[model samples]
Target chain A: MRRSAFRRSRGDAPFRLASTGAGVVLLAIMAAIGVFLVVKAIPALQANTSNFLTEKIWNPNAVEPAFGIGALAFGTVLSSFLALVIATPVAIGVALFISHYAPRRLAAVLGYVVDLLAAVPSVVYGLWGVVFLVPFMRGPSEFLNTYFAWIPIFGGDQVVGKSMLTASIVLAIMILPIIAAISREVFLQAPKTQEEAALALGATRWEMIRMSVLPFGRPGVISAAMLGLGRAMGETIAVALILPATFGISFEILGPNGNSIAANIANGFGEATAVGRGALIASGLVLFLITLVVNMAARLVIARRKEFARAA
Target chain B: MTTVQTGIQPISTGRRVKDRIVQMLVYLAFAIAVVPLLSVLWLVVKNGIGRFDLEFLTHSMRNIGARDAGGGAYHAIIGTLEQVLLASLIAVPIGLLTAVYLVEYGPGGRLARWISFFVDVMTGVPSVVSGLFVLAFWVLALGMPFSGFAGAMALSILMMPVVVRSAEEMLRLVPNDLREAAYALGVPKWRTIVKVVLPTAFTGILTGVMLAVARVAGETAPLLLTVFFTDSINNDPFNGPQMGLPLYVFDQAGRPTDTAIDRAWTGALTLILIVMLLNLVARLIAWWRSPAKRGS
Candidate 1:
C-alpha cells in the first residue's frame, strides 16, 4: 500500500505541474502582447513630428515623419458606437422573439441560423460590403442626405457610397448575431416562477417580458453589447474594404472620409517604411488599450451579475 | 351596471395594443437581421460562381497580373491549411491542459480564477493586435523572417482562449459521480482524469477544438501582419512568406480590374465554405453526443 501510494504521488505530481504550467503560459502570452506592442510603439511615437493624439493627418513615412491617431481614433469610436446603437434594440427584439415568441420546436433552429451569421468569415463580409452593400447604400445615402440634410451626420451633399455610415451598417450586421446570441441565452434563463407570476397577474406577453424577462436580462444584454462594441472597434478587414481610405476628424459619417486604426494598419502595412510601421503599431496600441478597457468592464459587469444572481 | 363594477378593472386595451405592436416589432427585428445574411450569401454565390472552377482551384497566380483571368487560390489554400494546422498543434494541448487544471485541479482556486478571467480578456484581443505582437516580437525583435509559422503563432494566441473556454465548459459538465466512482475503485486521480474523464468528454472537446480551428482559419489580419503575402506556392511554412485565402481575397479585391474582383469573390466563397462546414460539423458532433440527448 505504501509503495502504491508513492507511485500515485509521482504520477499525479507531473500531471498537476503540466496543467499548471499550461495556465501560466497563457498568462505570460497575455502579458507579452501588451509589453511588446508598447515597446515597439515608442520609437514611432518619438519620431512623430506632429502631435500623436490630436493631429489629423497620417503621413508617417515622410522625411519629417508626421503622423497622428486623432482621425483613426475618432472613426473607430464613432463607427463602433453607431453600430451598437443600431444593433442593440434590434438584437433585443430578436432575442425576445427567439426566447419568448418563437415556437419551442422552431427556436433551436432559428437560433442556429442566427449563429450561422457569425460563422461567416469577416473577409467575406468585406467582399460582400464592397461588391453589394456599397452600391446598395447609394440609394439610402441619397435619401438620407436629401431628406435629413439638417442632421450633421447626413449633411454631406455627395453620397459616395463608401462612407462611414456604410461601414457602420456593415459593422452592425457583423455584431448583431453576437449581441442577439447572448441576449437570447440570458432571456431564456429568466426565472420561470417570475414569468408565471407576471402572467398570472394578467400581464400580456410583452408586459410580462418587460417586467420580468427584460429586467432580469438587462445586465447580460449590456455586457453583450459591450462585447459587440469591442468586436466592432477591432474589426479590420471588413471596415478596411468598405471605407474609402481617408483621414479626417469629421462627424460627417455620410461622407467618404473615414478611417479606423485597424483599417489604417491593414491598408498601410503593405508599403509602410520602418517609421510608418511603427506609427501603425502605435495606433494599434491605442486600439488594444481601448478594447482591453471595454472587455474588462464587460467582464466586471458579468461578474457582478453572477454575484447578484447568487444573492437573489 | 353598478353590480358589474368591481374593485379590479379589466386589463386596458392600450396595453394590449402595445403588446401587439411590440410583438410585431420583435418579428420584424428577426426578419431584418436575416435580410443581410441572405443578401451576403446570395451575392457571394452569384459573384463567386464565375471564377470557382477546377482551373481556379488547381492553379496559382505565379505570373498572373491583376487583369489576368486564370489565377487560382491553390497556394493560398495550402498556406491557410498549413498555418491553421500548426496553430492547432501549438494551441490544443495547452488549451486542453489548462482546461483540465481549471476543472480538475483548481476549481475556484485563486490561480484558476485568475486564469479564467484573463482567458476572457484574451479572447477580446483583436486579430490585428495579435498579428502586431507576433510581428514585433518574432519578426522584428527575434529577426525572424515573415513566414506561415509566424502567422501560426499569432493564430495560436487567438485560438487558445477559445479552446480553453469551450473545453473548460465541457470538462465542467462531466459528472462528479463518475469521478467518485473512479476514486472508489482505487484509481488514482490522474489516471481517472486521463483514462475515464477525458474519454467521456472527448467528443465535446473535439467539437470545441474544431470550432476554434474554424474561427482562426478565417482570420486575415494576423496573417497580413505575420505571414506577409506571396503569390506562388510555398510549402514550407517556416521558410518564407505565405498566402492565405482571406489574404488572397483582400489582395485581389484591392485591385481595380474585373478579373481580380472575380477571383476575390471565388476566394471568399471558398473561405466561407470551409468555415461554415467546420461549424456545421462541430454543431453536429455536439448535438449527436450531448448527454441529455443520450439519456433521452
Candidate 2:
C-alpha cells in the first residue's frame, strides 16, 4: 500500500509542475503588458501633469507641449454609452423573440443572420458609414437640430454634414449584434423547468419570459453590454471615418466632428514621436484597465447569479 | 354597461391580447435590428458587384489609374491571407495545449483560475490596444521595424483567448468515460488526452479554430498599425508596406477618386466572401459530429 501510494505521488508531481508553469506564463504575460505600459507612459505623464488627461488641446509638437486625452476619452465613453442606450432594449427584445417566441426554423434563420452581422468587418462598417449612412443621417440630423435644438447635446453647429451623432449611430449598429447574440444565448440557457412551471402556473408566454427568462438572462445581458462597451471604446476605423471632432467634449451629439482614443491612435501613431507614443500608451493603459474592471464585474455577475439559478 | 361588458368578457381575453402584443413587439424589434444588416449587405452588393472581374481580381492596384479603369485587390488579398495564416500557426498550438492543460489536467486548481482570468482579459482587449501593445513592445522597446509580422503578432493576442476558451469548452464536452476507459487500459494521462479526449473533440476544436481565424481576418487596427497599407504589392511579411483587404478598403475609401472607391467596395465584398467561407467550414465540421444537427 505504501509503495503504491508513493508511485501515485510521483505520477502527480509532473502534473503539479506543468500546471504551475502555465500559471507563471499567464502572470508573465500580464506583467509584461503592465510593466511596458507603465514604463512607457512615465515620460509622457512627467512632461505633462496627470491632469493632462483632461486637457483638451493635443499639440504634441508644441514646446512645453500641451497634450491631453480628456476629449478623446469623453468622446469614446459618450458614444459607447449612447450606443448602449440605443441598442439594449432592442437587443433584449430580439433575444427574447428568438429564444422563446419565434418558430424553430425562423429562430434558426434569425440566429444565423445575426452571427453573419457579427462577423462583418469593422472596416466595412466604416466604408458603409462614409458612403451611405452619413448622407442618410444628414436628414435625421436636420430633424434633430430643428426639434431638439434647445437641448445642449442636440445643440450642435451642424456642418451641413456628418458629426458625433453619426459616429454614435454607427457604433450603435456595430454593437447591436454582440448584445443581441449574448442575450440570445442567455435566454436560451434559462431553466427549462422554470419556464415550464411558469406556463403550468397559468403564465402567458410573455409572462413566462418576463419572470423566467429576464431573471436568468440578467447577468448575460450585463456581460453582453460590457463586451459591447469594450468594442465601442476600442473601435478604430469606423470612428476615424465618421467622428469629425478634433478632440474635446462638445455639447452636441449630432455635430459632424469628434474623435476617440482609437481614432487618435490610428490617425497619429504613424506620425507621433516617442512622446506621442508614450501618451497613446498611457491612453491604452487606461483603456485596458477599464476593460479589465468591466469584464471582471460581468463575470462576477454571472458567477454570483449562478448560485441563484441553481437554487431556483 | 362598461363594467358589465368587462365582466362579461373573460379576463383571459385581455391577457391574450397582452401576450399577442408582446409577441408582436418582440418580432418587430428583431425585424428593425435586421434593417442595418440588410441595408449594408444591399449596398455592398450594389456597389461592389461592379468591380468584380477576372482582371480586377488578378491585377495589382495602381495609384495612377483612371476613374473608369480599375486595378486590383490581388496584393491585399494575399497579404490578409498570409498574415492571418501565420498568426494562426503561432497561436493555435499554444492555445490548444493550454486549453488541454486547463480542462483535462488542471481542473479547478489555482493555476486554472489564473489562466481563466488572463484568458478573459485577453478576450475583451480592444483590437486597437492589441496593436498599440505590440507597437509599444516591438517598435519602441525592441526597435523592430513595422511589418506584417508585427500585425500577425498583434492578431495572435486577440486570437489566442478565443481559441483557448472555445477549445477548452469542446475538450470539456468530451465524455469522461473515454478517459476512464483509457486509464483502465493502463494508458498514461498524456496519451489518453491525446488519443481519446482530443480525437473525440476534434470536430468542435476545428470549428473554434475556423471561427477564430475568420474573426481575426477582418481586423483592421492591427494591420493599420503594423503593416503600412500601400497601393502596390509587397510579398515580404518581415518588411515593407503590405496590402491587406480591410486596410485596402480603409485606404481606398479615404481617397477621393471614384476608381479607388470602386476597388474599396470590391475588397469589402471579397472580405465578406472569405468570412462566409470560414463560417461555412466551422458549421459543416460541427454539424458532422453532432447527431442532432442536420446537413445544410
Candidate 3:
C-alpha cells in the first residue's frame, strides 16, 4: 500500500517536468532571438560611417562603410500603408459577404477559398507578380499617371509596372485573407438577437448589418487590419521580386523606385560581406520592432474586445 | 406602452437603394478578391504544365545554364523534403508538450498565461526575422555551416507557435469527463493524459501538425538565410548548401531567361501541389473525426 501510494505520487512528476521544460524552452528561444540579433547588429552599427537612420545610400560592403535605412524604411512603411488602405475596406466587405451575405451553404466554401489565397507560397506570389502582374499593371499605372498626375504619388514621369503601387497591390492581396478571416469570425459572433431586432424594425439587410454587426465587430476589424499591416510590412519575397531595387525615399509610388528592409535583406544577402550581413540584420531588427508594436497593439485591442464582450 | 407597427412595413426607397448598392459592393469585393486566386491558378497551370514532366521530375539543375530548357527542381525537391522533415522532428514534440502544459497541466496558471501570450507574440515574428535569428546564433555564433539543418532550425521556429496554437485548441476540445473517468479508475494524471486524453485528441493533433508542416514547407526567406542555395542535391540536411522549392522559384525567376522563368513556374506549381495536398488531407481528417459527424 505504501509502495503503491508512492508510485502514484511520483508518476506524474516526469511528465509534468517534461511539459514545463518544453514551455521554458520556447520562452528561451524567443528571448534568445532578441538577444542574439542585438549582439550581431552592434558591430555593424559601429562600422557605419554615415547616419544609419537618415542616409540614402547603402554601401555597407566598402572599406568606408556607409549605409542607412532611410529609403528602405520609407518604402516599407509607404507600401504597407498603401496596402492597408487598399485592403481594409475590401477585406471588411469580403468578411461581411462571408458572414452575412453569402447563402448559408456557400459561406463555408467561400471562406475556404479565400484561405487558399493565404496558402499560396510568397515566392509563388513573387513569380506571379513578375511574369504576369507587372506587365498587366502597365496600363493601369499609366492611366493613373495621366489622370492623377496632379497627385504627388502619381506625378512621376516614369511609369513602370514594377513600382511601389504594384508591390502594395500584391501585399494587399496577400494580407486580405488574414483580415477577412478574422473579421468574418467576429462578424459571425455578433448577437443574433440584435440582428433579428434590426431586421424586425423594417431595416434593410445592409442597414441591419450596419446597425448590429458593424458596431460589435469594429474592434475585431481594426485588430485584423493591424495584423494585416504587420504582415505587409514584413513581406519579403514578393516585394523583392517586384520592386526595381531603387534606393530612394520618394512618394512617387507609380515610379519604378522602391526597396523595403526585408527585400533589401533578401536581395543583398547573397553578395554581402560580414558587415553587410550585420547591416541587414540591423534593418531586420527595425522591421521586427515595427511589427512587434503593431502586433502588440492588435492584441491589446483584442483583449479590450474580450472585456467588452464580458461586460455585454 | 405603445405597440410597435403590427403590419409589414416597407423600408424607405432611399434606404433600399443604399442597401442594394452596398450589397453589390460586398459581392464585388468577394469577386475582386477571387480574381487573383483564379488568375494565379490558371496562369501557373498554363505556364507550368509544359515543363512539369518526367525529365523535370527526375533530373536536377546540375550543370544546366539559365538558358537551358531541360533542367528540373529535383535537387530542390530533395532538399525541401529533408529540411521540412527535420523541422517537423524538432518542432512537433516541443509544441505538443507545450500545448499539453497549457491545456492540461497549467490552465489559468501564471506560467501558462505567460507562455500563451508569448506564443502569440512569437507568431508575429516575421519569417525573415526567424532566419536572421538562426543566422546569427547557429551559423555565425555557433559556427555552423549553411546546411539544411540550419534552415530547418529557422523553419522549426516558424512552425512551433503554429503547432502550439492548433494543438492547444485541439486539447481544449477534449471533454473533461474523459479525464474524470480515468481519474475515477485510480489512474495517474500522466497515464490518463497519455492513454486517454492524447488518444482522443490524436486525429485533431495530427491535422494541426500537418497544417503546420504545410505552412513551414513553403517558407523561403528563412531557408535563404540559413540554407544558402545550391543547384545540386544535398541529401544530408546537416551539411553543406541546399536548395528548397521556394528558393528554386525565387532564384529561377530572378534569372533573365525564358527557360529559367519556365522552371520557376514549374517549381511554384509543384510547391502549390504539395502544400494544397497537405491542407486537403488535413481537412479531410478533421472532417472525418469531427464529433458532430460521428454523432458522439
Best by DockQ: 1
Off by over 4 Å in 3: A1-8, A306-312, B1-9
Alpha-carbon shift of residue A54 in model 3 (angstroms): 1.9
Better of 1 and 2 by TM-score: 1
Question: Residue A190 error for model 1, in Å?
Answer: 1.3
lDDT value, residue A197 of candidate 3: 96
State in Å the error of residue A84, model 3. 0.9
How would you encode candidate 3's per-residue C-alpha lDDT over A171-218 as one tens digit per residue?
A: 999999999998988998899999999988788898899899999999
lDDT of 2 at A4: 59
Q: Give the per-residue lDDT digits (tens) of candidate 3, residues B77-127.
A: 999999999999999999999999999988879999889878877888899
lDDT of 2 at B87: 92
Interface RMSD per candidate (angstroms): 1.2, 2.6, 1.3
Backbone clash count, each prediction separately: 0, 7, 0
Consecutive 10-residue window with the lowest summed lDDT within model 2 chain A: A303-312
The candidate, 1 or 3, that scores higher on DockQ is 1
Q: How well is candidate 3 docked (DockQ)?
A: 0.74
Chain B in candidate 2 has what TM-score?
A: 0.92
